[model samples]
Target: MRVLVTGVTGFLGYHIAKDLLKDGHEVINFSRRHTSEVDELGIETIKGDLTNYEDIKNALRDIDAVFHAAGKVGMWGKSKDFHRINVDGTKNLVNAMKEQGAKYLIYTSTPSVVFGKDEIKNGDESLPYPKKYLNEYAKSKSIAERFVLESNGHGILTTSIRPHLIYGERDKNIIPRLIQRAKSGRLKIIGDGQNLVDINYVENASHAHVMALKELSTEAKNQGKAYFIGQEKPVNLWDFINKILEAKGEKPISSKVSLKIVYFIGLIFELVYKLLGKYDDQPPMTRFVALQMGTSHYFKHDNARVDFGYSPKITIEESLEKIKN
Candidate 1:
């Protein structure tokens, strides 16, 4: 099959493209910037922006399926900017897929869409989207994901995979940001650091994407459903970080800050960034960050396993070893 993967230069998209190629599928990568790294892997590359309907439509020509992995992800940003990239961009993609008569669309969503001030323990897809989102990123994703799922029966087979805290080799988000803060002596554990969170390895997360696409069908069970993908076991935030630091021969982080203090500091940062007109990018800390750091948000993957036969292949220990090396 011929597949077009948006955001192929991104962390998860890169792995998904590689996996597709290994499975003997013709892979075409769409991105704003052309990179020789993915090109060297023998993927056909197209430079395009997701927001532009023409660019997206051109890339869909002759494509069998689409993996919509591109998104605007951040804790802080103007609501309009997030809407343009996440919601409006997704609308454009869906419209293009309809015009090109694409068979399947597998959207990569986040579990944050269901998150709020309360803990989300053993939550499933049956749980409704939050009444209010903490940040623009989550709100936009919620809106976009709704469109993707609703477009399932409209001549397009669509499913969404919500992977939480994806981390592994080639990760440029959480791990690197934490290391940078640690080096700057700004790393502080929040809320006693006992919150359990789900972290998905890149390879396993990529495998979930492929499995969802392979399982796509006109059946109601396979159509218009979203699944939460993650490791089999949840890890305590502090324990996981300390283990990684110890394996890397770095000192384990011991200092801590109360959730109240962290929340206060995040409020200050939000106001300061707004006052400074720094809305183009994310602020150092935001309300969403505080909630995520201090709250336990894990999901039940029973639906994914039952609907798509999806199970994580890599163990947490194995993932940690790969990261350590």
Candidate 2:
């Protein structure tokens, strides 16, 4: 298969590309930025923007399947920018895929799409999109995931994989951010410090993408559906953070803050930033972050397992070893 991996410059997308190459597929990358990984992997790449329909159409010319892993991800950003990159970008991809007759599309979605005002435990793909999203990233991603799923069939098979709290080698977010704050002594346990959540090691998350790509097709059970993939077990959120901090040789976070106070502080930060017109700046305690840190959001991957034989290839113990090395 000639596979085109979008966002090969990104952390997860790069890993997905590597997995496809390992499987002896001819892999092409479609990304706006040129990175050493692409050059190092020696995969053919088409430099283009996702918002540009022409670029996506051209990128799909000879591609058999696409691992659409590109998107604007953030807790704070200009809503318009997120929409342009995540929503409009996906629209262009879906339309271009149809026009180019690309057979399969596997979107890299998020569990945040279903996140709302309440905490979710053991949530499944059956959970519907929230009535209101906590942040621009979730809103835009929800829209994009919907586009990818609804655009299924009509000669194009499509599905979305939602992975949560991903961390591991070459990680640009999540773990890195935690380590920075922990080392700086600014990290604190939000709420009760007992919330459980799903964490996906990078390799495990990327393998889920590979599994989806392999199983997606016409008449396939995975077609047009979304699946949540993560470690087989959920971990205590703060305990997990402490493990990473320990591996990085930093003291664990001991301070604690109430979710209500943090949420209020976040509201104030948001107002100040908005008034100052700093849409690109992220507030330290945004409502979204407060909810995420304070709530339990583990998911059930039974559907992913049943549909495409998905499972975490790396355990938390293995992940800690990788970080220590």
Candidate 3:
């Protein structure tokens, strides 16, 4: 099979492309910039933007499957920007897939799409999208997921995989930022430190994408559906952070702040940032970040497993050990 993976420079994208190559598939990396890593792997490269229909159409040529993993992800961003990249970009991909007769599309989505300022322990795919989104990123992603799933027929097999708190080796965003904040004495527990959350090991998350692509079809159960992919069990959010800190030779986060106070502070920061026209600057905190840290939002993976034989090939212990070393 010939596979096209967008955002191949990203950690998860890189993993997906690598796994495809290992399985004896022709891999084409789609990204705006070239990286030495991709060149060294001898994978074909396509330079393009997801927001451009022609660019995406060109990349879709001779592609049997696609992993649409590119998006602007963050707690803070302009609504228009988020919509353009996440929502509009996905629409472009869907159109290109249709134009070129691509059969399978496995979209990378986030569980935050259903976040409604509440705890969601053991949630499943049946959960509805939130009525009010606290962040533009989530809102845009929800719209994008809908577009992808709705464009299911007409010889296109599409499914969305929502992976929570993806982290592991070569993680450029999540854990690295946490460690940086911890080293700067700026990290604090937002709640009572009892919130549970599901996290995806990079390998497992990418493996799920491959499984979905292989099993997806017009008559397949996974077609047009969404599945939550993560570790077999949920872990305490702060406890998992502490484990990573320990691996990095840093002491655990001991300082604590009330969720209510932090949420109020986040609102103030968001307002000030928006007022000052500092779209490029990071907010001190955001309500979405506080809610994510202070609540339990783990999900069950039975749907993914039953639909496509999705399983985490790497254990959490093994993943942590790899990071530790």
Candidate 4:
């Protein structure tokens, strides 16, 4: 299969493309910028912006399937910016896929789309989108997810994979942020510190995409459906973070703040940032951040496992060792 992976420079997308190449598929990377990974992999590359219809259309010239992994991921940003890249960009890709006759589209979605300022235990594909999203990132991704799923049966079969807290080797964002905060003494437990959360290793999460692509059929059973992808088990959130810190030879986070206190502080910071017109910069605290850090949001992957035979090849212990080394 000639697979076109958008955002191939991103953590998940990069790993997905690498796996496709290893499986003997002709991989075409579509990204706004070239990274060392692309140069090293030496796969065919297309420089394009998702927001541009022509750029995306041209890149889909000979593609058979698409891994639409590009998205604007952030806790804070201008609503317009998130809409442009996440929602509008997805619309453009869908249009291009229609025009170019691409058959399958696998989107990389987030569990935050269903997060509504509450604990979510063992969530599944049946979980509904929140009445109100905790942040703009989730809102935009939700809209984009709908666009992709709703587009299914229009000659293109599409599915969304919602992977939570993906982490492992070559992770440029999540783990590094944790280490930086621990070093700066700014890291603190937001709640009672016993909340459980789902996490996915990069390799396992990327493999889920491959499984979805192979099993995607025009039949409704697999088409237009969304699946939760994660490790086989959930871990206590604070315990997991502390383990990573210990692995890095750093002290674990000790300071604690009640959720109510953090939520109030987050509200204040949000109001101040909005008043200051700091649209590009994230506030130190926000309601979304508070709930995310303090709540339990784990999910089961029974649907993904049964529908596509997806399972994590790397255990949590092995994943931690990869991070430590």
Candidate 5:
């Protein structure tokens, strides 16, 4: 199979490209910037932006399937920025698929799209999209995911996989940020630290993408559905962070600030940042970060299991061992 993977330079996209190449598929990597890192893996590279229709169409040419893994991901940004990259980019990809008669589309979505302030304990695909998203990232993802799922059944097999807090070797987001804050002595446990969250290892999350692409069938009832892909078990937030700190030979520090205080502070930051025209980087903390850190949002993968045999291969213990090594 000739597979085209967008965001091939990203953490999860890199793993997906490597795995697909190992599976004996010809992989074409699409990204705004060309990197020798992917070329080192012996995969073809296409330098282009997802929002450009011609770029997407050129990448889609002669491609059998697509792994739509590109998007703007952050806690703070202009809504237009998020919409342009996430929503409009996906629209471009889907339209290109329609024009080129691409066979399959496996969209990489985030579990945060269904999250707000509520405790979404063991929720499934049936859960409604949150009425109000805390940040533009989630809002744009929700809109784009709907487009992917609804774009199915037009001779294009489409499905979305929602992976929560993906982390592993080569991770540039969560661990590095945590280590930076810890080194600066600015790291703190938000809220009571009892909130349970689901995290996915990079390998397991990438495997889910391939599985979804292979298992998407016209007769399968889950064609237009989204699956929650993560480690099967949930871990308490504080305990998880402590494990990471311990692995690094460091002690975990706790914060005593109330959630209300942080949330209010985030609101003030948002207002001031908007008024001051300063939206380039993330705020010290945003309302989205506060809710994500303080609230519990683990998901049920029964649908994934039943539909695509999507059981996660890497356990938390195994992931920790990998990280430790």
Candidate 6:
């Protein structure tokens, strides 16, 4: 089998590519530019943008399956930019896959799609997309996930896997930024530090992707559905943050801030950033971040397991052992 992984340079994308390769499948990396990781993998790569239909079609022409993982993700960004990449880009991929007669599409989605300004305890795929989103990233991803799921039939099998707070080795975004913020005294515990959330090990998340894809190839029961993948259990949000900080030799974030205050501050910062056109700069706090940090959001993957045999190959304890300060 031949697989094309978009955003192969990214953390999850790289893992997905490696998993596919390990399974004896030929992997093609899709990205805007070449990276050392692709060179290390020594596989075929196509330099392309998801926004370009020609690029997508060219890459998917001979590909058997696709793992769509590329997108602009952050607490802040222009709505149009996010729409172009997350929404429009996914549309282009679906269309190109249909045109190329690709067999399967496993889209990388985020749990934030269903997370609004509320607490979700042991949530499942039965949860509905929030009618209103506090950030553009979540809203755009929601749209993109819907589009991918809706484009399910007609010679293509599409499903979405939403992984939350994914972190592990070669993580270019989550942990490093977290450590930096902790060192700078920018990170803090919001609420009572009792908010529970799901954090995914990179290996486990990659395993879910592979298992789900194989299930699609075999049983085909998971098409047009979404599944949440994460550690087997949810951890207290602040406790998890402190554990990472401790592992990195940084002081644990002990300062407390009110969620309401931070949310208001975030509102002001968002207004200022939008007015100044500083779309690239991430504010220290945003309403979405505040809600995420201060709320309880964890999901159950029983459906994924029952339907596709999706299981985390790496446990959180095993994953933490591999992390170095």
The 0-to-1 C-alpha lDDT of every candidate, in the order given, reads: 0.88, 0.90, 0.91, 0.90, 0.87, 0.90
Residue pairs in steric clash, candidate 1?
Answer: none
295-320 per-residue lDDT for model 6 (tens digits): 89998889988989987788777877
Please report, as a residue range, the 10-residue window in candidate 4 with the lowest summed lDDT: 214-223
Clashing pairs in 4: none
Q: Which residue pairs clash within candidate 5?
A: none
Instruction: List clash counts for every candidate, in order.
Output: 0, 0, 0, 0, 0, 0
For each candidate, C-alpha RMSD in Å? 1.3, 1.1, 1.1, 1.2, 1.3, 1.0
Clashing pairs in 6: none
User: lDDT by residue for model 1 over 1-325, one digit each (tens)?
Assistant: 8999999889999999999999999999998987877877788789899899999999999988999998888888899999999999999999999999888999999999888778888888998998998788999999999999999879888999999989888889888887777778887788888899888999999999998888894344668989998899888988887776665566678888898888888899999998999998677788789989887888899999988888999998988888984
Best by lDDT, which number?
3
lDDT, residue 256, model 1: 87
List where candidate 1 sits over 4 angstroms from the true fold: 217-220
RMSD of 5: 1.3
- The TM-score obtained by model 5 is 0.97
Per-residue lDDT over 9-58 for candidate 5, one digit per residue giving the tens place of the 0 to 100 score: 89999999988988888999999887878878887789999888999998
Per-residue lDDT tens digits for candidate 2, residues 1-325, read: 9999998999999999999999999999999878877899989889999998999999999788999998888999899999999999999998998899889999999999999889899888889898888699999999999988888887699999999988988888887898888777779999999999999999999999998888885347899999999897999999999899898888888789898999889889888988999986778778999999998999898999999999887888988999883
- Over 4 Å off, model 4: 217-220
